[model samples]
Target: MKYSYYALFTTNNQGRIEVTFPDLAPHVATFGNNLPDAQRMAADALVGYLLTAESLGIKLPQPSSFQDLTPDSQQRLIPIEVDTKSN
Candidate 1:
């Protein structure tokens, strides 16, 4: 919470977003076809990540930038598997 540790990004090539938390290891969530959805998912994911880390006795780090997660800027390709249930 001390740092602007959220990466908000939406790629035009595909309808999806990439959210990265620089503080926590393997802290990434991708499950959206757009920015808004991704942000929501990211928020939920972050809370869950923190809770899990706390239980595992891990200290979550805070980063001013997402440099650790990427070279210049970070981007992720999120594959969405849609399950359709119709009768």
Candidate 2:
């Protein structure tokens, strides 16, 4: 199955892009140097989180709509896609 979740993308002080999933918790974050790299890392991070949650028998939360989130000036919302075909 493939899943997509909304993530917040922002730049760190050092200029690397950071991605954070708001609806899913035990809060995790990832970083990359550019938009595409950041997007790839975000998907990886979400996939890891879902696998870990599954292992612990925890339920994954539904993704929030883009309109529901309020991002700061530094943050933009992006979609992170995860494929669980092998899992």
Candidate 3:
């Protein structure tokens, strides 16, 4: 399934590209020194995250259009706040 994700990208202190999909809590990663490279790396990061979640039986939040969800649940998928780093 293709879920719509909100991505944020910016240069890091070390000059690498930082990327985040706010919809996925604690699911951020980074790579490369530019946007294109960072994008490929981010894609890899998502695949790895999902694979690991499936392997460990972690429950991924179901994808939903925030408008179709309750206000509380909607917050989880919105990019209200973001830190300038990756984990």
Candidate 4:
């Protein structure tokens, strides 16, 4: 199954990119040194989160629409896609 979710990327004071899935658990987060790296990490995190939830039979919340999300100036809303079968 393929899942789509939004990742909130924010630049911290130390200049690192912090990524989080707002619709998911608050503890479900990842970070990287830069945008590209952060994006990769976000995808990996999303995949792991979904896989774990599936194995545990936990129901995940529906993804919020991109238009409905509001990211601040220091943050960006990015869409992430993951396929459980491929993983």
Q: Pick the candidate with the highest lDDT.
A: 4
After superposing candidate 2 on the true structure, give the runs of residues whose Cα lies further than 4 Å from its correct spot: none
- Better candidate number, 2 or 4, judged by lDDT: 4
Write down the TM-score of every candidate.
Answer: 0.57, 0.87, 0.59, 0.95
| Candidate 2 weakest lDDT stretch, 10 residues | 22-31
Q: Report the backbone clash tally of model 1.
A: 0
Superposed Cα deviation of residue 14, candidate 1 (Å): 2.4
lDDT value for model 2: 0.84
Query: Number of the top candidate by TM-score?
Result: 4
Q: List, residue by residue over 1-87, the lDDT tens digit for candidate 3.
A: 233445556566887767766567577555657777877777667766766766788887755455654433212223222221332
* Candidate 1 vs 2: which has more TM-score: 2
Candidate 3 Cα outliers beyond 4 Å, as residue runs: 1-4, 64-87
Write the number of the candidate with greater TM-score, choosing between 2 and 4: 4
Model 3 collision count? 0
Candidate 4 shows a clash count of 0
**lDDT string, candidate 1, 1-87, tens digits:** 221345545454565665655444366554567766876676566666655666788775654443444434456523222111210
lDDT of each: 0.52, 0.84, 0.57, 0.92
